[model samples]
Target chain A: MLVYIYDGSFPGLLTAIYESYYRREKPEEILAQDQWQHTLFAQEVVIKTDEKKADKVYQAIKDKISGFAARNAYCVFLAEVPGAEMLIYNYLSRGWKLGAKLDFHLADEAVLQVHTVAKKVRQEAHRMLGLVRFRLLKHELYYAQIEPDHNILQMISPHFARRMADQNWIIHDVKRGLAAVYNQVEWVLTPLERPKTISLDETGLFYESLWQKYFSSIAIKSRKNLRLQRSFLPKRYWKHLVEMDESRSRFAESSVLSPQSPVKTYK
Target chain B: MELLEKLEILANAAKYDVSCSSSGSTRKNKAGGLGNSYASGICHSWSEDGRCISLLKILLTNYCIYNCAYCVNRSSNDIPRAYFTPDEVAKLTVNFYRRNYIEGLFLSSAVITSPNHTMELLTETVRKLRNIHNFNGYIHLKAIPGADLELIKEAGSLVDRMSVNIELPSASGLKLLAPQKKQDLIIRPMDYIKLQIYEHKEERKISRKVSHFVPAGQTTQLIVGATPDTDLNILQLSEKIYKNYELKRVYYSAYVPVSEHPKLPQISQPPLLREHRLYQADWLLRFYGFRAEELLNESQPNFDLELDPKTNWALRNLHLFPVEINRADYETLLRVPGIGVKSAQRIIRARQVRAVTFDNLKKFGVVMKRAQFFITCRGKYGGQISLENKLLRQYLIAKPKPIQHSSPYEQLSLFNESVPSIPSEVMLSNLTGEL
Candidate 1:
């Protein structure tokens, strides 16, 4: 089986797709050279990183499988899963033959793996849709930060761009250090090396107080099942939730108000 | 105060009302807004019991004058109560919206001072959020049952959606459970809101102007298992509400045994599976073109808890089975067991250019295990079944007999029974003829 290798990049993966299609002889495995180590009885082919080849391969997949499938497959590659290259290679070759019908039940191992990876990426995309909390910056740019499990920077960009088309926004993936920026008409992604910083308006504290008060008021005291709440939403993610901010200030004030009684209530 | 303490009192009160969803609305923020509504609503985080804490589903106050037996916040229950001011609510919404912790507000309250007094407070809060605070986000306001029509109308104008819960399915149930509330009190406000929405829509067509009606439409909640009401009775009420009021949705909240009450059922947990079946039945009524009478009647009060509503219906009506996959219409295809909207749509689209075989049906996402007995593709059947037998009806809908060993005493003792009993083979022999 011929093993195809490319630099660990989305474009480079597209270049590998170009080589696999150009050579009519299909291989048993496709491995990235960086991830590939010495293996016995394996025929290796190094694919030169070419933009034109990558674009051609990308266009072919879009025309053949589906535009959605092409994008999803590219994202599955970004997940950096072990044996993702071979999975993509098998998926593409079979996808061309099966058309849109390839998504349903099948016996092929590669097809199964691709389906699992696609589902995982899709799940992450959905989570980010709800979790990407945007904080308004002083510069009128709606800025948000998230640390998602997958590289879902590009997956959620179009949704916000279309929905918030009138406003300027930036959603930075803290873990991946990438950002999706929308300026009126369209959106673009770049390495988030220098994000636009903003000063906290004095009204920020006021808003926080109001939110903490509301959160406290709305919560049902009788149904305060902490075990159940913690089970559904872990305390680990509580730092990002703004309603929990009052506890810090409440701690600072509790010493002055109570000399002996325990600070039982937060906010 | 401990947020936990407040949450316990308020949520326990709110939990009984049973309308905790941020879905079924399609509202976007206008210009100069910080947040927008998602078509398929956003669930920011899930609560401990796996409930979606999407919106801050809470009440303005737990103090009510009405005596509703099912409600923990009923005037009869001497519990500690709290209320949030209009400014407090608006401020809360803005902060929560900014943090992406909530989509908007689901503000419900008991009739604190009076119907008008509570309605005014609720409307004031929503108005402040929209006009004073410039907060344009999704808001679902609960209309007080006996509130003045004008106040309810004002609330409808301010919020995206409004719900007046029909807690009991029957007027008799209401009389027994909540003597203070009347059927007309709940249904009238809903009727007024419905008419106002229509009136606004009709006026907007003539002039290039927009009136903020209840843009997301109105919904109501029905508390299940609280009273001796059948599924047929409940669904009949739902059908009436849907047809007459033009409701966007009817939320069915399975009754949870919160307090040790003599009137309520002694259920250990909420009949969630039954509620799930009702939701499935509701979907069938809304989307699948099934009537309420077809699924339930006076004789069969409860849904078949063992089987899903669609599958149960399909099994009972065996004559409709073995439908031709390639030729059946969309509605006909929807009637097939185990076929959801997505699967049916996939089949219809995939079979447009080519004939479908059993193998091809698998590719179209048909659940082969369940669909195998129900569909034929290219004159080929996958399961062995006699289609013409009159006894198939008996085979399909027969309820499984409870095993003698399954008794509570037997379960607790965990001891072998020496009593005379029907043998396994004998039981199978008896059931096989019925099947």
Candidate 2:
């Protein structure tokens, strides 16, 4: 089995896809530089990142199939799954053969895997639109920090820019160390220094308390469903919410409808 | 009064209006505007009751002239009343949107002084939010019933969506529960908005510069379990409203008993499962191509709480079962128990290349547990038994978890003798079958 390794960048993965195609042999796995494991019987190939080679493959995908297919590949690239590098390569090779009709091959494993992985990225982007909480910084720019499982900063920024067009805001992806900043005009992506700390203003604290009060007051005391709340806005996303501050979650514990009865109240 | 005090009363009054969606409007942000709307709504937070909070749902004022019996803000209730000026409401909306606390504003009100006077306030508030404040966030305003048509029309053009609640399902139910709110007064504004929405589309097609009216269309709420109106009556009414008004949604708010009217149920909790079943049947009517009359009838006026509306419908129509997975049409595929709109489309696309077996069908997102009994894979049966026996019915619906006896006395009596205890419907059905 031949295993190909490359740097952990989108262009690097596309270059690896190009190398495996000309090698005329199917590799068992495509590994990022950090993700490689030593196996006794496997042959290894190390590929360097080449912008020209990656561009050629990307353009070939758009020319042969459609730009829509190229977008599918890009979304899958951001998924950052362990072995997505090879799956995308195989899917595109089949696309070259099928031309614009490649999307019809939903039964193929490589095609279905890319579609499934891209769907996860799309869902994460959609969920972040709802879950992102902005804090008014002392500097008066709206600042929000998210640590999503997927790298969805680029996908979700356009939504905030369209909605919060008149305000200056920054959405920092803490896990990925990148930020999408909107300066009351167009948005720009820049590298963010990790472990970013923000100081909240007095007005921000005032509204935060009001929001926490409104959030707690709106729920019906007779129908408290923790499991349902956890399913929609999971525990992982709770830490970022202004309403899910530590005191209220503890306050919520004493207000469970009934600790014993799990039956939905209806006949 | 403090902002917190006013927010508490207004939000408490507005909680019963269960239309929480900030969806279906494609309004975009202008150069200096504050926000935009997405086609599918965004939910910012979930409350402890597991309800989504998409918009800052608050009443403009809780002071009222009319006393609708079911309303928490009725004049006889003796609750504290508060009002927000138009400037205050618009500033609140812009501030909340900036902090990502809400998608937009859902502004509703009681009949302050009179209906026309109240609607003028609502219109002024949205007009300021759009024109003066330059806030383009998704606004869902209330269309005050019996308000002047000019006021409703002028407000409809400024906001993304408007709703005039039918409130009760039947005219007699309206007369009994809310004596002052006649059926004609509620529906007249609805019809006017519907016609304006229709006319705006025609106007937009003729010239690209013509402004859109109520771009997200209209929606309304119907209170479930407050009256004798059955599921049949409610669904049929919603069907007419959808067909006639081209309504975007018909939200069902399970009656939370806040008042002690003699005609209403004296239950401790809302009929939640009934509301859930109504939502499922409503989905069937909207997306699954099932008509209202087909799901329920006069003989069986209510839905079965044990099973979902789709599964219940499939059980009643046994002859439509065991559809061929490889050859069935899209409509027939949707009728199968586990095949939804998404999975059905996936099946149509995937089966064009190769024959789909039951295993492959699972990959397309068909719930194998439910679909196995309703479909055939290349003339091969996947289910153990067809829909010929009652066991199939029992297997499809999950048995409710047994009731826990947490009290000490009830637990102590368990060791005394043979306790012929039936904790759930599953056990009761099993015991009756044995006898």
Candidate 3:
């Protein structure tokens, strides 16, 4: 059995694919260098990332198979799940023969595997569009910390750049030690260390408290279903959300103080 | 009053309005604007009651003049009343939006002095947010029923969506519970907004420079289990509204008894399962190409408690069952018990390349448990039982066990409660009878 290994990068993966075709031999397994496990009987091949060769393979996939298949390959790489590299290699090998009709062959195991992994990555990126809560630090820099289940920092940053175009912000992924930093013009993804503590500005605390007040007051008392609530916003995401934390809400203390009158005029 | 206190009272008052969607708009941000609208809306959070918190749903004020029996903020209730200035509302929306805490603002209000006056307050707040704050987020404004047409038109041009709630299902029910509201008054603003949206779309076809007028279109809400209306009445009304006005959604809210009156039912719990059934039937009308009259009739006016609407319909019309999976078109496939829009489309796409087998159906996202009784693969039936309606129903009926609370101590505390817990079998029959 033959095994192929490359550095864990998108270009490196594409280069490995390029080698499997031109070398005229199909490897039994394709893995990233970090994920390689030693086996006694397998022949090992190491492949380096060549930019020109990776670009040729990328252009060939887009021109021969379809642009949609090219996007699916990129999303699967970002997913970084175990055995994803092998799935993409098999998908492209079959896609080269079927051309643009590759995705329509959903009954095939290779095509279905690529489509399913890409969908999971896209869904997590969409969820982070709403779950990232930003806090205002000193000097007016907006900072948000997220611990997404997948590597979605690059996937969701373009949305924030388009929506919050005039503000400087940073979305830090604490689990992966990565961040997407934006400077009101463009954004770049870089490695970032998680901070031990974070301090909010004066007005930040005020707005957070106000948001907590709105969150608690809007729930109907008669329809209290914690099971349903956990289904939508799962318990794993509660640590970062401001409204879900019990210690920060102060809801019980505030509701105890009764108002003076039911009718009051305001200017 | 502090702004925090006002927000508490007004937000609590507005919690009963359950139109929480912020979708169907693709409004782009200006060069230096603060935000933009998403095409498919993002739900920022879920409340404790399991509802999606997509927008900052609040009221500008809770002061009212009309006394509706079912409303918590009726004039005779003497609840805590507070108002926010237009500037205050604009500031709150911008701050909350900056923190990524909400998609936008869902500003509604009680009829303070008159419909026109109340509408002016709501419109002015949206205008301030757009012009002064340079905010381009999704905004859904409520159109006051008896307000002038000009006010409704102006509000429509500034917001992403507009709604005018038809609180009761029927005209007579509206009269019995809310004497001050008329059906004609509620529908006038809806009709006017529909015309304006049509005109805006036509103008945009001529030139791309025309601005949007309610790009997300209109939606409305109706209270369930409050009047003597059946599920048939609610579904037919929704069908008429969707056909005539081209509404994006019609939210059905189970009546959470805020104040008791002689006209309202004395039930302790809301009819949530009935509301869920109505939503299911509504989806069949909108997406599955099923008509209202086809799903329910005078003989059987409500959905079965153990089965969803689609399964019930399939069970009644057993002649249509055993549809050949390879030969059935998209519409026929949609009528099957467990086949949905996504799976039906997947089957169509997958069949173009290869013949789909029964084993391959599950990979395309088809739920074979309910579908096995209704579909065939290459002229061979996959169901385990004989094709009889009664036996098929017995096999298909979802037997959801009564939810067991974790602790026996909690069940013991319920012994002193006024309402006795009914057995699951009796409760199921009772729910079907009541609906």
Query: Which candidate ranks first by DockQ, i.e. highest?
Result: 3
Per-residue C-alpha lDDT of model 2 across residues B1-435, encoded as one tens digit per residue: 998988888888888888989888898888877788888989988998898989998899999888777778888898899998888888888888888889999999999988999999999999999998888778999999989999999999999999999898999888888999999999999999999988989989999797889998999999998888899999999999999889989999888888898867788899899999999998898999999989998888899988888888899999988899889999999989889999999889878877887877888899888889999989998896776877998888766579877854454464779565556776877879953
Q: Rank the candidates by lDDT, best first.
A: 3, 2, 1
Cα lDDT over the full model 1? 0.73
Q: Is the docking of candidate 1 incorrect, acceptable, medium or high quality?
A: incorrect
Clashing pairs in 2: none
lDDT, candidate 3, B98-185, per-residue tens? 8899999999999988999999999999999999999999999999999999989888999999999999999999999999999999
Q: Report the candidate with higher DockQ, 1 versus 3.
A: 3
TM-score for predicted model 3 compared with the true structure: 0.91
lDDT tens digits, residues A101-195, model 1?
66542434556578678878887787667667665555555567676667877778876764555567778775776777777766767666433
Q: If you assessed candidate 3 against the hidden native complex, which CAPRI class would it receive?
A: medium
> Chain A TM-score of each model, in the order shown?
0.73, 0.84, 0.90
DockQ of each: 0.20, 0.54, 0.64
Task: Give candidate 3's whole-model lDDT.
Answer: 0.89
Ordered by DockQ, highest first, the candidates read: 3, 2, 1
Off by over 4 Å in 3: A37-39, A246-267, B400-435
Winner by lDDT between candidate 2 and candidate 1:
2
Question: Model 3 captures what fraction of native contacts?
Answer: 0.86
